[model samples]
Target: MNRQTKGVLLAAGGASLWGGSGAAAQYLFSTTDISTTWLVAVRLITAGILLTAISLAHAPQQVRALTHQRRNVGYLLAFAVLGMMNSQLSYFLAVKYSNAPTATVIQYLQPVIIIVWLAFAQRQWPRRIDCISIVIALIGTFYLVTGGRLNTLTLTPVALFWGLWCAVAAALYTLLPQSLLKRYDALAVCGLAMLVSGILLIPSLFTIPWPHLSSGDWWLVIYIIVGGTMLSYTMFLQSIRYISPSVTGILSAFEPLVATLLAVTLLGTRMTVAGVVGSLMILLTTFLQAIPMQKILNLLGLKHHY
Candidate 1:
């Protein structure tokens, strides 16, 4: 595959896994006594250990080098605490307060947040297509969340608060790992971040009551650690290597669509027609924003500018 194709695929794959994982987590929450705190802590720690081990076998020298450098270590620590930890913890907290739909839709605001930050930081406006995509995303998110009945959803203040926080955390999660990815294996970076994040969450885990689980629940927990946290994070960090964080954020919008589908299939939730259409728009906007202009033009038999 071409570079752009690979990048988009990686992002989409990662986002899909994340969406499925969220659905799985929602299942656990409804059926078990697992606190979000324990879930987050264990996921980070376990994912961290496994990912780091794999990377160590694949690129031991680089992993060792990263540890030896104080500056790099500092960066990793910050990425872990501020980026990975904040994003994962805040997201689960949001879900704990509200349902998956509320949390996911609100956190989907990350793309807009990234876009605005980029615009301000670069002191320039986005292209017309970018603006159009953003507007579409906004409309789609609104429809998906509210289902055309603006007053149908009722959210507590805590839910609203954590939902917004997840937005900020999502933005950070996409943006913070770029430098690390440039200098180290993406797997190693994510693994270490997850490990550190787990350590940081250790105290919080103790405070929360641990949930009793059946054998099936343990299997589900394994899926969250391996498929959700490990695979999703590694692929996510990998995407930034070939695409901008803004585009990655947009592409990650696939999460909500997947989440909604899984919800309908497994949780017996109903999806309104407008909600489905809105989900499509959100996904379409992501690809519309992600596809390179040259690729689209070539497909249409147009001349290239350079």
Candidate 2:
């Protein structure tokens, strides 16, 4: 297979696993008394150890080199607290308050958040297409939360808050890793970040009572840490080596698509027509942002130069 084909497959598989993990988390939230705090802590810690081990096996010298750098280590710790930890914690909290599908869809607003942040930081207006995307995101979010009804909300106020926070955290998660990713291996940086964040959360784990999970629940937990978090992250990162980041971003829509399907079918979650429309609109923004402007102009048959 061609590199692009392999990349597509890898990206899709990774996204699907991520989607499935969200559904699995919803199941645990619905059936058990597990707190997001404990679960996030354990997942990060365990996944960190396993991923770190793999990174060590593959490139022991690189991993050791990263630890010896003080400046990069400081950056890694900041990312651990403000990026990885916040993103994971807010995400599952959003899922708990809303559903996996809604939370996942809302989290896709990360691109929009990043765009806005960049515009402000650079002291420039967003491009016309970006402005359009922003408008679409607002309209879509309205319909998603209210389901076309102004007086009644489909999602609770708390759910909406956490969902928006999840988007912010996700944006931070993407942005804060740039420097580290450039200087060190992605897996090594991520593993160390996860380890630090998990360590920080360890005190909270003791504050909350341990959950009594069945054997089946334990299996789901393992899947979330291994298949969903570790393997999925590895696959998604690997795909970028074979394809453009834009292509990988576009393919990531599968995460929400799979999550929505699993939530609706397996969990019997109900979504209104307006809600579905809103979800599609929100997801469409990702494609719009991912597609290069030249390609979009070609599709529209506009030959004017930028």
By TM-score, the best candidate is 2
Question: Model 1 over residues 1-306: C-alpha lDDT tens digits?
Answer: 787777888888898888888888888888999988899999999898898899899999878877889988988988898889999988988877766655776776676678878888999897666677789878876676567677864456687688879989988987987887888877888888888899888897778888999999999898888888788877887888887766786778778878877887878766678767666776666566566776678889987531
Question: 1-306, model 2: which lDDT tens digit per residue?
Answer: 999999999999999999999999999999999999999999999998888899899988778877888987778888999999999999999999999999999998998999999999999998878888898998999899999999999998899999999999999999998987887799998998888898999999889999999999999999999988999999999999999999999999999999999999999999999999999899989998888987768889997542
Residue runs of model 1 more than 4 Å from their true location after superposition? 1-15, 149-157, 232-254, 294-306
List candidate 2 segments past 4 Å from native: 295-306
Please count the clashing residue pairs in each candidate, in the order shown: 0, 0
- lDDT (Cα) of model 2: 0.92
For candidate 2, the TM-score is 0.96
Clashing pairs in 1: none
